[model samples]
Target: MDGSCDDVGGERTALEDVGVLLADQGLSDAFFLERGLVKYGDAEAGNLVVVQVDEDGREHELVTGAGEAWLELRDAAQAEGVLLEMVSAYRSVERQAEIVRGKFLRGLGVDEIFAVSAAPGFSEHHTGRAVDISTPGYGVLEEEFEESAAFGWLEENAGRYGFTMTYGKGNAYGYLYEPWHWVWG
Candidate 1:
């Protein structure tokens, strides 16, 4: 992901039609530049592998490298008596726009929406390397997950498996603290 102003949509296989994707949700090129956001190309659909199927039976997929790392990380955590589960992974640029649009329809302002959700093409989820994780006995995607043993375990051990928490208190990107969001390099 980089901050280049190169045409977001072209013959480039790595990038998406980000301009149209954002505009559909009422965002503009200025929004990205004003926030100093980095653009993340969505991973090729074929490059993803199913990592898990949640209680709701929705499949979670990640890029092959990330999928392998996630499995290893989960096993290691289980060995240490920590249960890790994936709540989200591998979102597309279209899905990101839908999320933003949904928030807007729910009465959130653009600033409010971006505080928790990245703009289309800016979310690491598009790269298939970022994940939202939770453990048993906690509400999914809630801030309370930060208080769980899983968060502590991840804080202490996730780096060994190549994952790092992306949004913390007062993060530079101005997003709310998301202790459960992590990305594998």
Candidate 2:
């Protein structure tokens, strides 16, 4: 009852072939990345699951599995006086593309953008399993959120809900430390 998405193929081997993809539109539509498996397009056709995380009717969709766990985590945090809010949730390919474009227009080179942002099709947001969380008194998506009481609470308890902070101050992934970004297992 977790969730589902497109399944491409199950068997994978180091390919001796490497070639250029003129475009990845169809390729992406035919596959998806998941926590532990590769998904083919048909899996998402009728069973792709998402859920709204906000009461504002914005349809802030998140992968159903993560959405359910996030709700539980949020409630638990609230009970402890630590309120968590979703500032950014699932993003479509189009939206991710726009974000990268905007960053380029703002003078960020591709390398710099990739350091802080994922390049469209390569974004975690595409899977609907990643979220940018925030709380009261600090700006959404700001590093300052790291110093908030909410972050402290999450640091101590998020793993209980199958969540993990993706980028830490000096860890791996070659991306900027993103304390606000959490991905569900």
Candidate 3:
């Protein structure tokens, strides 16, 4: 998070805003570099489409290409008796900051939080291509998802739909092995 933060509509303004937010959260300007993290630009609002509406009425969205690919992947999995559910998709930088702030309020340090969550403007979710997924009978966002039939199906077939697991065991980014996270291009 060194130089600038980018949103579809604005770069300099978004950079300033994200910088202030990170400062408020006590993050250093070199946070991303220190963690070997990549900064992601926000998706264009017009390019996003609702991919799923959660039980709590929250809309999980992705950029059109990824959203369409996700739907196709889910349908293909269902046809094979593997159900995939969207846990999270296309998070905003603001929402990411709130998540980080919540972790801080809960007494977690930035190091602990970064192990599981990306710094606000650096999350892949901000790009509208990443998704957190789960299946029936598994806890959402849990590592146990790696043991599910859905995970097996994804490992075998998600690539055909242009999705790949982003965070794996011992990932270079230093995040925990997040078997539930994937990104579509």
Candidate 4:
């Protein structure tokens, strides 16, 4: 697969090659990346379901139908001795903006932050269908996660729960490869 991890029977796929999963069919109209996020607004957000992240009960919200799959995936991993944890999930536009604002305060320009964090409305977290996962040893959202046992577990089993790793090594999304960021399809 070289730097690109998405391969389809000898061919490769990119973001444009697939549909971006949203919180619900209704959220398709949220907002786009270039316009920049001014506010967070999802009509369906009110009905989002909050689920326990793991046995310790960290809570995270996702669209109505995702909680069960998350639990199922967690249980599956636990069976294999992996303690799954959530670093982030269901972020709001305001939260995303705050993250960007914090980065800027620390000297990162908008373009620099955009390369790593999606501008408010453009973030998958807006849909509540995306989650940044973590295992204790690898830290959160680090490239080193790719070398962990948890990463291998996800690569092998996440699909059965309808989860997919969105960014690959040379992905076209411009975001860095995120072995920890997964979208529930």
Question: Model-by-model lDDT, in order?
Answer: 0.81, 0.65, 0.82, 0.68
The sequence of per-residue lDDT tens digits that candidate 4 reaches over residues 40-134 is: 46543555788755567767898876667887998999999997787788877666656654564455654576568875556878887888889
**Native-to-model Cα distance after best TM-score fit, residue 92 in candidate 2, in Å:** 1.6
Q: Pull out the clashing pairs in model 1.
A: none
How many residue pairs collide in each prediction? 0, 6, 0, 0
Candidates sorted by lDDT, best first: 3, 1, 4, 2
Q: Give TM per candidate.
A: 0.82, 0.70, 0.84, 0.73
Candidate 2 wrong stretches, greater than 4 Å: 1-57
The best candidate in terms of TM-score:
3
lDDT of 2 by residue, 11-85 (tens): 321110000110212323223232222332212222234454467666666777888898899999999999998
lDDT (C-alpha) at residue 134 in model 4 = 93
CA shift at 105, candidate 2, in angstroms?
2.9
Query: Which of the predicted structures, 3 or 4, would earn the higher lDDT when compared with the native?
Result: 3
- Model 3, which residues run further than 4 Å from truth? 1-26, 43-46
